[model samples]
Structures are given as structure tokens and as C-alpha cells.
Target: MAASLTLHPDRALPLDREQRAVAREIYGQTAHLPLICMHGHVEAEVLASNTAFADPARLLVTPDHYVTRMLVSQGIAPETLGVRRVDGGPTETDSRAIWKTFCANWKLYRGTPSRYWLEHELVEVFGVDQVPSAESADALYDRISERIAEPGFRPQQLLDTFNIELISTTDPAGSDLAHHAGLARQGLGERVVPTFRPDAVVHLDRPSWRDDVAALAKVSGTGTGDYAGFLDALRERRAAFAAAGGLATDHGHLLADTTPLEPAEAAAIYDQALAGTVTADQAARFAAHMLYVFAGMSCDDGLVMQIHPGVLRDHHAGIAAKHGPDVGFDIPFAAEFTTALRPMLQTYGHDPRFRAILFTLDETVYSRELAPLAGAYPSLRLGAPWWFLDTPGGMQRFRETAVDTAGFYNTSGFVDDTRAFASIPARHDLSRRVDAGFLARLVLEHRLNLDEATETAVDLAYNLPKIAYQRRI
Candidate 1:
């Protein structure tokens, strides 16, 4: 018989039996609520097709960077993980072999949040009573593979099983959202929605930036060779996405500094950009101006704008060249949100028409930059503890620094921010559990009423992410 996998509860709770029961009670209260995933990177194609997933390794091991990075760290190859690139290539081919390699390296995840999530998925989702290790790996893998290949384990079925009411998939500005349209026509309207991501069009320094903008111009039937035309093209695309049920726009800029340049200056920069002769500063200027242009568009369109700044993307040149992005190579840099967001916020913050949701990797700025800005501005709102800080320690740090000043309402709720399908429930469940632990602290310490903590817990898990992202469409 396989041993039961142990759960590592947070140390914040007291060691006594009575306190642990309180923790259980808090979890029980929030466990059954409908999940709200306002921002994430799960493929729309999975839901649109409603197809059965291939196998356990294909679903969990290969596609997830969190899994692959750890496995690779333990001497597993990226090819073994089945990561695909733009050129239709991968390092490894044999699915069975990949599963074997992953199983051998499963101990790499010990004590990680991934370990907890994966164990939960194995036990709860797949009915695996045994712990996953090299010893029982093949038995667990084969059973999971058999179940995933079944009709009852299809994407839609899994979504329903996971109790996901609202999920937002991030899309590039140039995207036609054809899959999303298909899903809606199939009557999966509330199940999935797109969030506008102008990264491809706005990040002028990106390798394929000009071509992506050109694609946008052609698809929207608007000329983007010039500054005015570029804005018009983006606006037209936004309208199409709006009609398709996208609610908010997401921007991942290196800096939050926004610039609304005069037409002539913007035009000159656009000319330089199209000619591929622009300097680094010119590109920054153009990207900054485009942010302002996006805000102006959002005011007219009623789509909430989200700004996630301060990630020094692809920090390791050697790792990035070999592995591309989202390979666990991204690093956090010191960010200045107050002054950086000033150019955009000063112009749009007072306007009720414009709502901007801000996220940061810089925890130092939570109280200093984010809290005060979100607390003061009508357009601005704080996003949840993002990518790096989604862990228990990170969430605690975020709440400690920001909650007192910004309050819970100023901040949006949890987003899984994952591309992997199986991990969604696990991620949301972890967030719910952590929030309960935090609120439970408030009740135990007399910082808040027990009843109010319950309501707040529900809001953090279910309501705030949806409401703050303004994801009606």
C-alpha cells in the first residue's frame, strides 16, 4: 500500500489541535465558492476544441516552465520536457521517455508549492492514492494517462469539475481571437474571455515588433506605417476584441513611465521606428507614448487597463538564448511606480472613464509606490501578488506592506497566471487557502471580526479579481 501524502500547512497557525480546527473551519467556509480567474495564460484552443488531453507528462511536465526549470536543474533536458518553439521544433520526441525522466526527477519538486499542487492533483483529480516517486511513477503515470485520454477528462469537463466560473486568457493586440469567437458561438461565453495585451505592438525593441504591427494594420484594414495610423489601427483592433468580449488590456512594460507625445514628435518617432533606424531612447519614447495612447483608447472603450511593470525579462543571456522566455530566467528589478506611472496617471487617474490596474514584481514599492497611488487615484487599482510573489511568503509580504494603506478593495484578487491546464484549480486553491490563513490571523489577533473575515475571504477568492479587472464582456 502507498503512503498518504502529507500536507505542509503554514506555520502561522498555532500548533495546538483547536487552532488547526479553526484553520480547517476557515478553509471549509471558502472552499466551495465559485472560482474567478481574471488573468492567466491558458490556451483558448484547449477550451475551444474541448479535446481530451494526451497524457500525464504531456499535460503537466512538458508545458509547464515551473516543472521544466526544476527538472532541467536536476540535469533533465528541455527537449525531454517537450517544450515547443516558434520554429516547430523541440529537443525531445519520445513521450514515454520524457515521462520516465520526469518521474526520476520528481524529487526535485520536494517542499515546493509545485509539490503540493501536483500531489493535490494526483490525489484529488486523478484519484491517485499513492505518492508520486520513481518507485510508483509508472503506475501513477499510466493511470493518469488512461484517464486523461477519456472523454470525461476533456478540457470543458475539467473546467466544470474545477468549478471555474470566469477565466481570462491574455491575447496579443494583433490577434484575431478566432478561437475565442468559436468558443462563444459554441455557448461557452462565461467560461472564457480574452484580455487585451499590447506587448507585441508596444514593445518596439522586440525582434518581430514591426511585423506584428504590420499584421495588426492589415487585419484591421488600417495603415500603421505612420503614428496616427498606428493608433487608429490599434483602436480598430481593440474594437474587434471588444465586440468579441475582451474586457481589459494588459501591458508588460520594462518601465511604467508613460508619455503622451505631441502629434509631430510622435510622428517623427514613428517614421524612425518604421525605418528601423530608431535609437534605444527613441524606442522607449515611442513605447511610452503608445501606453498613453492605449489609455486614451481604454477611456472610450471602457476596457480596464492593467500595467505589469518591472520584470527584467530574459535576464540570463545564456539560458534565454537556449531556452527562450518563461523558462524561469526572468528577474525582478527595483521599480519606481509613483514617478513611473505619473505620466499616465496624472493625465488619466482623475477620469472615471479610465481604470488602470497596476501590478509589480517590486515588493518594496507596495507600501511606498503602489499603495499610495492606488489609494489616491480613481483610475488606478492594485493587482494581486503577481508571478514571483504568488507563494505563501510572497503573499504574506504583499499584504503586510500594502494592505494597511491600500486596503483590500484597492487590490484585485488572485489570478493563477499559468499556461498549464491542470494547475489552475491547484493555484486558486492555494490562494484561497493562504488568504484564509491571513484573514484567520486577523480574527485570532482581534484585528477584524470573524464574520467580516469570512466575507472578505470570499471576495478575495471570487469577486475582486473579476470586478477589479472589469471583465463583463
Candidate 2:
């Protein structure tokens, strides 16, 4: 017999009776607030077409690197989980087999955020009543597949069901944003917006950098022979994104360095990069310089700037080469924001027109570096704990450490930062529960009254992200 699945109503509440009651009250005030997903990796085309999702394996197992990476760590191949290989290698083509593999190894995800999100998706989103196991995998698969085929389970319909007020999809700098335009025609533009992501064009060390630059020139209708023209092209693209209802720009750099180089020096480095003669040091320096340039552009324009630094992406070259990037090999390194961001912060930290939300994977920096920096700079806001640190314990640590220095207002509230569309509500719901528990503890400690905690819960859930992302709607 398959075990029955149940989501305890008080799953993340405080253990103490008095504190749990306060948490429940606080949670009640923010439970149903509309989600404001300021930054994520979901494609606009999915919603633009409102297409029905594929089978359960494709929808749930394949695209989630968090799930596949865990399975891979336990000696299961990613291709066996339905991940396509870039080298045309043989992979498991059967979706049912993939589902069975995932279901068989479900226990590996215990105490993981991925498990929490997956359980919430299965129970709340798909209405599945049986826990996943090797024995029940096929039956669960058929049930989810049937439900996904229905019109009410389409992408756009799910967005409404999830109560996503405003969601942003990351787009390459050279993208035409045709899907965004199409959504506008379909009258869904205001609900979904594009985010300007220029990593491919800015990171000169990537093997595809030149090809991406060529594509940027083609789309921006600008010359790439000179640095000035390249900057102009990027500026033009940002403007186009703004016209398409974009509110922010996202940068995923290995480091948070914002040191600026002289224009001639920057131009020389760009020329070397274009000539295929730029050294690794030159590439790093140029990328750092471009970060400063991006901040200046954000100040000139009004797009909120988000920096997610300190990730060593594609940590395993063999896996990356075979399966492509974002296959869950990215690892975090210690980040030093105090010195790395000094140049840009000194330049724009006090500028009212400029806004930056900084995310770090390094937990050690919360109290020592990031919180103090955010406390000092009016333009800087601490982003929520992200990537590897988005778990329940990580969220609790973030609140405990950063709240003392930066306080609630200096932080940008929860952002899902996900590619898995169905996990958005689950992620946000987890955040709300975690925040309510944290606030409840504060009330229990006599640091705050119930009324204050209640209002702050609403702010953390809904108001802060809207204000921080600069979303008009």
C-alpha cells in the first residue's frame, strides 16, 4: 500500500505553543497575498502561448536542477533523469522511467527545500494524494499527466491560480522580446515583464562571447568595432527592455568587483578581447569595469539593479560540457562586498535615482559585510537568502543575522529566483511561514508587539518586493 500524502498545516510554525499561536496569527495576515516574483528564469513564451505542459517527468523532474543534481550526487546519471546531453550522447528517452527513478529516490531529498517545494506542488498544485514511490510512480504520473492536459492547468491559468501579481523573466540582452510583445497583445503584458540580463555579452572569457557579441550587434543595429559603440548598443537594449515593461537589470558575476577603468584602458581591453588575445586577467578586469558601467546606466535609467555575485558557475567542466550550464554544478565562494563594492557604492550609494539589491550565497557575509553595507547605503537593499541558502534554516539565519543591522526596510523581501514555474507559490509560501515564525519569536521576546509584527508580515510578503523592484503595478 502506498503511503498517504499530507501537508501539515503547521509544518513550519514555531514549536512552542505560545509562539506558534503568534506565528499562526502573523501567517494568517500574509498567507494569501499576491506573489511578487521580481526575478526568475521562467521563459515568457510559456505564458505567451498558454500551452499545456508536457508529461510529469518533463514538467517536474527534467527542468529542476535541484532535483537532478541531488540524484546525480547519489550515482544516478542526469541523462537517466531526462536531462538531454549537448554532445548527442545516448540518454534515457522514456519519461516513465525517469519518473520512476525520481520517485524511488525521493527520500534523498529529505530536509531539503527541493523536497518541500515538490511536496507542496504535488499536494496543492497537482492534487496528488499518494506519496511518490517506485510502486506508485506510474499511477501518479498518469494522474498528473491527465490534469496537465486540461485547459485549466495551462501556464497562464496557473499564473492566475498562483496569484502572481507581477513576475519577471530574465532575457538575454540581445533578445527581441517578441514574446513579451505578444503577451501585451494578449493583454497579459502588465502581469509579466522582462529583466535585462547581459552576462553573455559582458563576460568576455566565455567561449561563446564573440558569437554573443555578434548577435548583440545584429539586434542593437550598432557597430562593435569600438567600446563606445558596444556600450551604446547595450544602452539601447536596456531602453528597449524598459519600453517592454522591464523594471530591473540582473548581473550574475563571479565577483562583486565594481572598480572602474579609464575609458581608453577599457577600450584597449575590449579590443584585445575582440581580437582573441585578451588574457584571463584582462577578461576579469573588463567584466568588473562593465559592472561599474552597468550601475551608472541604472542610475541614468531607472531600472533597479540586482547583483548576484560569488557563485562559481559550472563547477564541474565535464558535466557542463556534456549537459550544458545550469545543470546544478554552481557552487558558492566567500564574497567580500565591503571592498569590492566600494567604488560603485562611493559613486552611487547616496544617489536617490539609483537602486541596487545585492544577493550573496555566502552566509558569513550577512552580519559582517552585507548588512553593514546596506545599513550605510541608502541605494542598497539586501536581497533575500538565495540559491543554496533559500532553505528554511538558511532563511532563519538570514533574518537573525541581517535584521539587527539592516532592519526590515533595508531588505528586499522574498524572490523565488526559480525556473520551475509551479514552485513559485510553494517557495513564496515557505518564505511567508518562515518570516512569520521569525516575527513571532520577536514578539515573544518582547522586541515587538503583535500589531507591529502583523503589519511587518504583510510588508515582507507583498509590499517590500513591489517597492524594492520599482514595479509600478
Candidate 3:
């Protein structure tokens, strides 16, 4: 069966061998270009310490819910896969057992992107080719576990091996950039920096909002019990992030909705939020005002603002109650970006001095809502298809809808937008192949020339992200 299989180029309509060969050639040309990862949520300390990866399962499987969720969907238990419980309850201690559990369920990922990424990591990264099923799990685990103990497998070494030019990680508002500063003190050649993400402190409706705000005050030396002092602490943290090479701010909100509320009304609501007396509507208003406040700060601080909205994060109440956030329970919801952002958009949307990149999990917004907004607004640029919409089908649908109006330049190019380091190159490689295959179709249809398509491919893969994030930071 393995000998009978032929590799296929990523596409909407599949292509024949000649087309696949051309796709491979195009992909080969740009495969080694330095990676420009403008957005992600990796812990900065792991890279700063430059440690060799732990056992393969811990480094690769536990952090990436993409793999865990797929395996879980096939009836594998999260606890068995080493997913941590929010209540501090532990899982199986044996890492090899976790690998066996995953390997036994590997068939669930067949014909899925996870399968592609995993298989590539096996053959290209670990030099193992046999498909990872129950029969081969032990051999694969032992080999990778041994390789993980090598110096060449250190995080920094992998960065160099992957040719990553600049990487940014998300940190909460109160986090001191001590680790990032340490990395800078070491004088690493490539840039690895923080991006300010204030969700914990800003989302006052969260059950732990008061505690989060108190933490912010503790870190930044400002009184966060009041609105004015809380904002002051946040601004100070932003300055620290900038000094430590932060170039941007990232927002994960339920909606792209933003508005400015009357100061007196906002202050009263903030008091209630601090006292844990806010209602659902009050929570939405509070989040909206905070987003607007961040927008104003970005105008002053010169940080590129990124908003990823339309996610009903932790939709599974049981999972959220047990395992906390980003536990594969975050699902796509309908969004109203054009109207939702009108209040903030009207005020700052025309300002060339301001820059905000908008991302949505709601695919229906791509053409109807997002493209027109990005096409018209001076402050807004459409972010790459993200989260649920970050698939081959998702990317294809995005280009089809957004490019016709906003064109490629108005878009911010490809971002793997993943926390999985083992899968990063595979993610980027998948994007490049998809782009090349799309361009090959364009050339065949006479919609674009080979030269223009080639240039576009390079920009999508390399130049645009560097320029976009650089121009702001």
C-alpha cells in the first residue's frame, strides 16, 4: 500500500503528476527561506533557557492540542495523553505509555493535516518512515526519545536549523520581560521577542478577573483596584515589552466589537468589575472599552495591534472547568466585524498612524464582512485565516474570497499561528505548497504570469511579514 501511493499537491481540485512535479519544484525553491513568524503563543522562557527538548511526547504532544484533540476524538483519554487538569490532578506518569496511546489511535488522523505533519516529522525530522501505528509505536518513541537527548535538538539549535529570522511570543500584561531581556543579553543573532496580550487583566467578567488585576498591580507597581491605576499599570507593562523588543499587541476577544464609553459610566462599571458585581452585558461593554483603550495606546506606543475574534473559547463547560483554557473546546462562532468595529473603526480606522490586523474564526466573514473592511480601512489589514479556518480548505476559501477585493498586498501573508514547535516547519511547508499549487492553477488558466505568481509566492512566504511587523515595531 505504501509503495502504491503517490504524493499529491495541496489543492481544491487535485492535479496530475506533471502538475504535482511543478508544485514540488516551486515548493523546493522557497522551502528554506528564513521563517517570519509574526504571531504565536510559545513560552519565552523555554527558548531563553535554550534547553534540549525533553522526551518527544512532552515537547510535541502535550503542548499541541491539535494532535491531542484528534487523538481524543478517536476515544483516547486526555489524561492518558498527559493533558493537565485544572484542579492539579495528575495523569499517567509513564511517557512511553502516552506515546503508545497516541500511536494506537494514529489511524484517526489518516487523510487529515495532522497525519501529514506527523508523517513528515517522522521521516524528515526523525528519519523514520514506517507509519506510526500500534505495531511501530515503541520503536518510534525510543528513537525520538534518544534523539531528543541530543545537543542538535535544543530549541535554539532548531531555530537555527529551521532558519527562523524573527519569532514573537505572546505574554500577559503583567509579565516582566526578564527572560526576553536575558535572551537579548546573551546576544542571540535572530530576534525573539514578546507581544503584549492583556486578556487576563482586561476580561473583567472572568471568574478570576480581580485576582488577575491584582497580579498586574503587583508586577507593574500601580494600583489596579481602580480604573485609572489599572490602566497606568498596563501602560507601564507595554513600555517594558517595547524595551525588550516587543513589536505588537495581541487580543483574543469574543467579538471584534469595540467602542468608547463615557468615562463616568466606564469608571462605575470598572468599580463593579473590580468588586465582582458585573453582569453579562456589562462584561461585553467592559471588554469593548478596554479594546478601545488599547487601540489608543497603540497609537501612542507604535505597537502593531492584532485582534483574533469570533471564538467562543472553552465552549465545553466541562473541559473548561477541568482543564482550563485552549483545551480544544474553543469553537468558531458567528461574527459581525464590520458593524462590530464601527465605533473604534470610525475613530481610528482612517488614521495611517494606527495599524490593526484583524483575524476571524468565522469564515463567512471573509468576503462579506472582512474583505470590504480591509479594502476600505487605512488602519486595518486582514490577518491570515486562523484557528478552525487555518486548514487547506480554509486557506483556499480565504484566498478565493479576500484576494479578489483586498488583493494579496492588503493581507498580512501566512502565519502558522501555532504553539507546536515540532510542527512549525511542517505547517509552513503546507502553506507554501498550497500557495504554489494555487499559483500553478492561475498560470494554467492565464489569470497570472509565471513571473508574477513566483514573486507573489515569495512575498507570501517571506517578505510581507518582515515588512509588516517591521514597519510598525
Candidate 4:
């Protein structure tokens, strides 16, 4: 017999009786507030096309690195999970086989946040009642496939059902943004906007850097033969994004260094990079200098700058070579923000127009480096726990560590930086429950009154994201 699946309403609340009661009350106040997803990887075309999802495997397994990476760690091959290979290698073509493999390994997710989100999506979103396992895999697959084929299961309908007030999609610097434009034609533009991410053109060490620069020049109608022309092209592209409702720019670098270079030095490095004569040290210097340039552009353009540094992307060389980027091998390293960001902070930390949100995979920096920086700099705001640290325990630790120094206003609220569309509500719900529990503990300790806790819960869930991202809507 298959075990029945259930999701308790008070799943993530505190264990103490008094605190749990307070948490329940606090959660009730903000649980239904619409989600404000300021940063995510969901493509705009998925919603613009408004197409019905293909199957359970494609919907839940293949696109989610969180799920696939776990399976890979357990010695299951990516081909079995239907992840396409860059080398045109054979992958599982049958959806049912992929679904069965995922279901069989469902128990591997024990005590994981992925398990919580996946279960919430299954029970609450899809009305799935039976626990996923080898025995029930086929039945669950058929049921989910049938539901997806229904008109109500389309992407746009799901977004409406999720009660998402606003969401942003990350786009490369050279993107044409036709999908975003298409959303506007369908009267859904305000709800979904683009975010400028220029890593491809900014990172000189990437193999495709020259191609990306050429594409940027073509799109922005500027020549890239000179360093000044490249800067002008980036400025023009930022303006284009702003005109199309973009509110933020995202930077993902290996380090948080933002040192600037003199014009002659910067131009020489750029020339070396373009001529394929740049050393690794020169490339690192150029990337750091570009971070400073990105800040200056954000200050002039009013687009909130979001820096997520410290990720050593594609850690597994073999996996990365076989399957392209985002195959879930990214690892975190120790990050030092105070000294690394001193140059940029000194230049624009006091500028009223400059707003920068900082995120780190290194939790060690939260209380020591990040909180102190955000507490003092008017333009700096600490981004929520992100990537590997976006779990319930991680969020709890974040509140405890940074709240005293940075306070609630100096921190950006939950952004749901996810690629999985179905898990948005679940992720946000988890954050809300964890936050309510944190706030309730303060109330139980007599540190905060009930009224103040309620207001702060609402701010953490909804209001702070809008203010931090400068989202007018």
C-alpha cells in the first residue's frame, strides 16, 4: 500500500507552545499577501507563450537543478533524468521512465528543503494525494500529465493562481527582449519585467566573450572596436531595459572586488582582451574594474544594483564539459566584502541615487562584514539568504545574525531566486512561516510587542522587496 501524503498547515512553526501560537497568528496576517519576486531565472517566454507544460518529468525534474543534482550525487546519471547533454549525447526520451526514476529516489530528499517545496507543490498545487514511490510512480505521472493537459494548467493561469504581483526575469546584456515585448502586447507586461545581467560581455575569460561583445554592439547600435564605444553601448542597453520596466541590474562574479582603473590602464586591458593577448591576472583586474563601472552606471540610471558574489560556478569540470552551465556544480568560497568593495563604496556609498543590494553564499560574512556595511551605507541593503542558504534554517539564521545591526529596513525581503515556476508559492510560503516563527520568538521573549511583530512580518513578506527593488507597481 502507498503511504498517503499530507502537508500540515503548521509544518514549519516553532515547537514551543507559546511561540507556536504566536507564530500561527503572525503567519495568518501575511500568508495571503501577493508575492513580489524581484529576482529569478524563469524565462519570460515561458509565460508569454502561455503553453501547457509537457509532462511531469519536464515540469518537475529536468529543469530543476536542485532535483537533478541530488539524483546525480546518488550515482544516477543525468541522461536518466532527461537532462540534455551539450555533446548531443543520448538522453532518456520517454517521459514515464524519467518520472519513474525521480519517484523511486523521492526518499533521498528526506529532511531537505527541496522535499518540503516539492511536497507542497504536489499536495497543494496539484492535489496529489498518494506519496510518490516506485509503486505509485506511474499512477502519479498519469494524474499529473492529465492535469497539465487541462486548460487551467497553462503557465499564465498558474501565475495568476499563484497570486504573483510582480516578477523579474534575468536577461543577458545582448538579449532582444522580444518575449518581454510580447507580454506587453498580451497586456501582461507590468506583471513581468526584465533585469539586466551583463556577465557574458563583462567576463573576459569566457570562451564566448568576443561573440557576446559583437552581439551587444549589434543590439545597441554602437561600435565595440574601442573601450569608450563599449561603455556607451552598455549605457544605451541599460536605458533600453529601463524604458521596458526594468528596475534592477544583477552581477554574479567569483569575487566581490570592485576596484576601479584609470582610463589608460582600463583601455589597455580592454585592448589586450579584444586581441586575445590578456593574461589571467589582467582578466581578473578587468572584471573587477567592470564591477566599478556597473555601479557608476546604476547610480546614473537609477537601476538598483544587485551583487551576488562568491559562487565558483561549474565546480565539476567533467559534468560542466558534458552538460553546459547550471548543471548544479556551483560551489561557494570564503568572501570578504569589506575590503573588496571599499573602492566602489567610497565613490558612491553616499550617493542618494545609488542603491546596491549585496548577497553572499558565504554565511560567515553576514554578521561580520555584510551587516556592518549595510548598517552604515545608506545605499547598501543586505539581500536575503540566497542559493544554497535559502532554506528554512538558513533564513532563521539570517534574521538572527543581521537584524540587530542592519534592522528590517536595511535588508531586502525574500526574492524567490528560483528557476522552478511551480515552487514559487511554496518557497515564499516557507519564508513567511520561518519569518513568523522568528518574529513570534521575539514576542514570546518580550522583546517586541504583538503589533510591532505583525507589521514587521508584513514588511518582510511583501513591502520590503518593492522598496528595495524600486518597483513602482
In the range 162-213, model 2's lDDT, one tens digit per residue, is 9999999999998989999999999988899999999999989899999999
lDDT of 3 by residue, 361-473 (tens): 88888899889988988788888888767777777788889988888888888877888877777777778877777777777778888778888888989987766665352
The residue ranges of model 3 lying beyond 4 angstroms of the native Cα positions read 1-22, 471-473
Q: After superposing candidate 2 on the true structure, give the runs of residues whose Cα lies further than 4 Å from its correct spot.
A: 471-473
lDDT of 1 by residue, 205-253 (tens): 6778899988898788999978788888888888887888788888988
Q: Which candidate ranks first by lDDT, i.e. highest?
A: 2
Give candidate 1's TM-score.
0.94
Q: How much lDDT does each candidate structure score? A: 0.80, 0.93, 0.81, 0.92
| RMSD (CA, Å), each prediction | 2.2, 1.1, 2.2, 1.2
**Candidate 3: residue 222 lDDT (0-100):** 91
Tell me the deviation in Å of residue 427 in model 3: 0.8
The better candidate by TM-score, 1 or 4, is 4
Q: Write the per-residue lDDT of candidate 4 for residues 1-473, one digit (tens) a residue.
A: 78999999899999998899999999999999999999888988898999989999999999999999999999999888888899999999899999999999999999889999999999988889999999999999988988889999898888789999999999999998889999989888888989999999988878889999999999999999889999999999999898888999999988999999898998888898899988888888888999999888888889999999999999999988998898889999998899999999999998888899999998889999999999999999999899899899999999999999999889998989999999999999999999999999999889999999999999999999999999322
lDDT of 2: 0.93
Candidate 1, which ten residues in sequence have the lowest lDDT sum?
Answer: 6-15
Question: Pairing residues by index, what is the TM-score of model 2?
Answer: 0.99
> Per-residue lDDT for 260 in model 1?
72
